[model samples]
Target chain A: MADTQLEADVTVNAVGSSCPGPLMELVGNAKDVDPGTVIRLQSSNEGTEPDVAEWSEESGNELLDVVDRGDHWDLYVRIDD
Target chain B: MTANRPSVLVLGAGAGGTMTANALRRRLDADVTVIDKGRTHRYQPAYYLIPFDYMELADQERDTRELLHDEVSFVEDEVTGIDPDDRRVEGEADSYEYDVLITAVGNDRRPDAVPGMLEGWNRTDSVYPFYHASAAAALGDAVDEFDGGRFLVTVPDTPIKCGGAPLKLTMLMEEHIRKRGLRDDAELVMTKPGAEVFGTGPKAPYQERIEEIWDERDITFVPEFTVSEVDYEEQVVRSAEGDSLEYDLYAPVPPQYGHEFVVENSPLTDGGEYVSVDDNTLQHETYPEVFALGDNADVPTSRTASAARKQSHVVVDNVERYLDGRSPAPDYDGYTACPILTEEGKAMIAEFDYEDSISAPIVSRLNWFLDVNVIPSLYWNVWMRGYDPVP
Candidate 1:
């Protein structure tokens, strides 16, 4: 099966955060989760959604889904390595 | 001595040090330790206007106590030594150990950098360096009482916080003389060490603007002339290259140097005597637990508060990584920012990284407005609070 949130073992909640907040939160939480688990980042910094997801994508993590809920964004990423 | 929490000792409470302490407290749960020698913290940018009644020096300074809160453990003491191997910093009255140490002790203006800079300062009113709060008061007195003559500003072969400050004073004085209807009577000359006016090539708009003002105001530009002597009595400034410029009113920026504690304590500093850290990680090359930022770091860039704010991110990140037992992700792009104030109304905000690359242009009033009003408030509020607007 294709690797996605469906096969994920972890989830990260980085809600109510902004630019560096979301990224910082994600980076900090990324260390604790097992290598294959998924981290779901939620934040209101619309400007940093693509940035966070891109950072995750480049750093050996699989960006599963990015959803903008107007008030905030839910960035889903599965830690591949 | 008996804090309930482990302390994070921060040395120096100036722009870089203050920002580092405040930012650390806001981000981490550890106890914050801030040490500085002075009871008063002066907002230095306002010094440019103090001579011309644009701002007050007293208004620029704040009770250092008013700036700190319950979040930080404040110590009014001068830093004497730092035992990085022992992880302790020696203050005037106490020695405190730190879980993490941040060196924000900023640069000091040395009147002795040039041979006769200090001598001229005491011997004549014609020579003044915009290096301290006192210099502004002295220069203000000089500007107000002068009737008319040649007002000269010489920039030494050293790096200053605001690169354009000396020249900015030159322009404002030209405006001051013009307003006083002494344009024909007063001749303004800027003696500088560099070839360009604004430093960045992209800021040609600013360079052209300054040159235009120089032409219109009849202010002469002397480039690459390092000041050698200040003959207060003879009213002459001799460049090290044997060039000479005469002036009735002379303003110069004193040479800057690193703190003695750092130079004497650590082997990290170069001949210029700054903490030689990798610009991106901000961690000491030989020591991982030690990190430095701001004016003290030997980062080849314009030393300004704007640069410090950007460096704060890198410092914060590397510190967090070190706390997490992971190798630092080196990502500091040597970002630096400066707001070149053309006048009371016009300001050009310049932001760039290690390459003199422009991050933001001078077109926006928001950035200028940030420099004039917003950033200063945020510096006192958020930056001092250990919180940064990182978006």
Candidate 2:
């Protein structure tokens, strides 16, 4: 399934946030969610993709995919077991 | 004898001072206090957007009391001078003693630095400066009423906060005039003291591209011209090298220097009238317990907020290491970034360091979005809040 189409266990709304905001929100909220749960993160910041990509990799979270939504983006991250 | 907590006194609650104070509060058990002349804290980069009427002065300002961490004590008083030997700052009302002193009072516009710069400033509507809010707003009004004649934008002979501001203003005004149907009547002239528009640094390519753009846009570039006097009555700009230009609207960027109080009182200042610190460590060369950052530090680079952000990290780390009783290893490499707004929605991100290499000018709406959207939010929420998560 497309990342944007994936059923998310938790939706992290980072809309209207800037660089590192989406990433910081994800980092802060990821611990509350259970393992194997896919977290949906949305952001409009241009510097978000690379930051989230690197963060997910470094934190052992599985990044499902990043989808461009014109004005913003939807990033899916699956928490690691 | 009563035991007093080791204290850190930060001078000038600007970007560098605020960030340093907040970061140190988290890392140390010391009492962190920040002192400034006023309670107003500004996201100065937003000043550039004002003249174009994209933002208002209120949008760029936040009270320093609210922006600073609650744990960090905030003092709103004018600093008269610092007695380096006594490790105390004499303020207008009271004196503050510190175990460690960090001076972050950035260089501010000195209209009097040049002969005619201050004399003619704001005396007439024909001459305006866009570096400050009031002046920027006035300049905006002037630009709006300008029907025709020469619109001259000038750069200072000294280093400035944003190297891209003068060019950005010229470019934006060109588009504004064109949109208002006055392009043919108004001639846009960019005058700089240097032979080159931008220094022969990593910004060369971007400068070259700008040259091309200006040429195609019918904007004239006058190089190696310094404004020595502005004959506000006669509407003439005179350069020290005996060159002169007549203009209906003159936007001058006067030379900037360190805070008068800090420069005159503290022996930490260099010949440039800024704090003399190690390029990397940001620690004062003569006094190890004293450090400086931001535009006030004589670091042989353009004074920029981006440079201050980078320097903040290094200064915080070294300060922590110093308190831990270790020799400081300087790690700052003069990294700075300037988001050059080309038109309304397009900008180029110019990122480079002390090394004469630059990231090729990346011009796009996305970059503009970062400046108009991302950077400001990050500055207030992440950096100032003392949570610089990004290294």
Candidate 3:
């Protein structure tokens, strides 16, 4: 999937936050949104990528794509029902 | 020897062990004994400031015998193995038996774990692993003499004690360079194996504040750059990802791991490097009589002295309950505090528990004073003496 093609239902700006911060924010927002809701998490912390991927797998959510934006990362996740 | 008076054996007279032993001595009628190889107990928190000559090694050093309560027995022996099944710990000098065991033998520094790191420290003038006392003192001289070029600090990809220490050291070095009128000539750089500078979870506020501070100071932060080797002869550090950076001076936090006795000899760790304890109760999963705290415990939190201080309280309470034939309480919430010194007189107290951040992420002189001036004194007088009113 292309980075610019998909539109997120919710966006979490977690830039300048580290490890569990981005992941925590993602989890927090993911809980409030609907099951099929697509969320975009932008984070500068490098660990967030793997953490989000692991969380998605463990939580049974769909990780759409991970985009490198030079300075930060954009991770798209579809919440599971 | 009697059912009424149980004997407690504590391992390693470090922060957690010392505090727990002293507290247990006062609270319970049980006979408490602490076994450690070292005669001197060094205040490890002051290691970061030693490079800047903020605190002396002598001032931080105290005899192990002096720290413990008079009623508590102090055994000077190097632990060779631990037999949880037999309720015994084998030391180099002799084997000791115990009714209850608390393992707090903190992690070991292994510069040799990384290729060329140990060689770099020995052979080159530039390489200084500042976690060690001698290296910290030597870095002071190196810092004094350094005029220009890249002043780099690297954190190893390990769950290190005081996770915020590398960040504090990096920022302090940047400030030092600026103060010496070498900011324009020298490049300040810090590398971590992970993406963040300080950490994540409830540390978002502090991490954000640190990012802003680093940006204003022009201190470069390199993420996911795990140091593979230090080419001391060429004055360059190569990362596992094939990236290399040349430096004029380097202070690297050495790779740390649990002692072989705990991980290899004892079944307490349950095949992990550290003593595998319940994060909340701090009791060994398989052995109810076994408890672990401090850097040695596999707690999902920053392994700071502050965390150990808090854990000490819970461990003491749980041990008391255990002696009274009660179930251990889940008291420890993974609470830890890191006083991040942004500059000489400025710091931010990043305090947090398992789920959330508790302290405001505000940099101030008061916080700096609390960390540098008050904490050390309190550590020696109150906390070490087992008179922790705060806990």
Best by lDDT: 3
Clash pairs for candidate 2: none
Q: TM-scores of all models?
A: 0.77, 0.80, 0.82
* Per-residue lDDT of model 2, residues B319-371, tens digit only: 88887789887798889888888888989888778886567766799988989
Residue B366 lDDT in candidate 3 = 100
User: Tens-digit lDDT track for model 3 on B1-391?
Assistant: 4677888999989998999999999999998999986656889988889888889977998888999989999987778899988999998679988899999999887776888776676555788777776577667778888999999999999888888888888888888888899889999899998889887888899899999999998999999899999998899999998899999999999999888888898898888889989999999899999999999999999998889999999899998888888999999999999999999999999999999999999999999999999999999989988778874
Task: Kindly provide the TM-score of model 3 when superposed on the true structure, using C-alpha atoms.
Answer: 0.82
The 10-residue segment of model 1 chain A with minimum total lDDT is: A12-21
Candidate numbers, best TM-score first, in rank order: 3, 2, 1
Clashing pairs in 1: B22-B386, B23-B386
TM-score of chain B in each prediction: 0.91, 0.96, 0.99
Q: Which is the better candidate, 2 or 3, if ranked by TM-score?
A: 3
Task: Give the alpha-carbon lDDT of every model.
Answer: 0.71, 0.79, 0.86
Error of 1 at B102 (Å): 0.7
